[model samples]
Target: MITNFLLDHSALVPVAILLVALVCAVLGLLFADRRRILWALAGVSSLPVFALTLVPTVHTIDEILCTVQFSVPTLGAVELLANVALFLPPVCFAALASRRPVTMLAAGSVLSAVIETLQALVPAIGRACDTNDWLMNTIGAVLGALIAAGTAWLVDRRAQSGSSTGAISS
Candidate 1:
């Protein structure tokens, strides 16, 4: 039955889809010079994965605990750290790779929020879409963006200083 199928692998299906998308985004960013287009594509690609988190299901607290336990020993820490970790790296990478930090951060945050909302809708996920998650995700993305900005600034400053000193003069 459709219900049975949804029950059996719903969690995994979404996670798998998202993971594939993430991989593709990373590959595209790394190989492609069209940074803006890649960023936009990455942003758009995250939506369905996030939305999957929101789908209603029969998840119980015990189920959530089991999932967390397999990956991390401490459930409490996982709740706090997992989402932040999940969100931060890609945001950082995207921001660093792209010319537009604000746009990347905004897109990442929005996608995260959408995922949280979708998760909230899924009663089976056993996790409510908390405003706290959104806030934390946004903060993580901002931190990533700041790091990217700092790196860019340092690179630019070094380049300018080098040019002024004719470091490359033949």
Candidate 2:
């Protein structure tokens, strides 16, 4: 029964990895006073999660039953978007939490590509190491970093306005 379930939801591996990373990031943030270290761990955890997502598998009956089919363009787009979307959360979180958008984004992109390359080495996984995926994922990390920067700016602006008004100065 378990084997059947595993076959049915092979994609769960990546989801599980992502969950673990999220937990680790949260725990690290809570325990580590050093924001830099926490952000670094968050970025590191995101790499394995991204790679697990890229691991391919032969279409088993369970996969078909689960309606896990991708059209060509759709698959292509997913390949492209997955990198960015998958890595964005970690990058954004690190940037927001650490206030280091550029560093976190760069680190996340490099770590993501390294994970993808490592996954390519495993034969049964069926995923090829595509340079394009690396590029798309990097773009995603950059976008996430920008988002983080924007959030920081908004927060700073709000704080400044709040202090100026002094709650009843009007």
Q: Which ten residues in a row have the lowest lDDT in candidate 1?
A: 64-73
lDDT of each: 0.56, 0.60
TM-score for each prediction? Answer: 0.53, 0.57
Name the lDDT of candidate 2.
0.60
Regions of candidate 2 where Cα sits further than 4 Å from its true position: 1-48, 54-76, 167-170
Error of 2 at 56 (Å): 7.2
Best by TM-score: 2
Tell me the tens digit of each residue's lDDT in model 2 across 48-123.
Answer: 5655655456732221111123332232243454555566667766877788899988987887677556555554
TM-score of 1: 0.53
TM-score between model 2 and native:
0.57
Candidate 1 Cα deviation (angstroms), residue 133: 1.4
Tens-place lDDT per residue, model 1, 69-162, is 1232122343433354446556755765675678879987997777665555544766666665676567657755665566556656766898
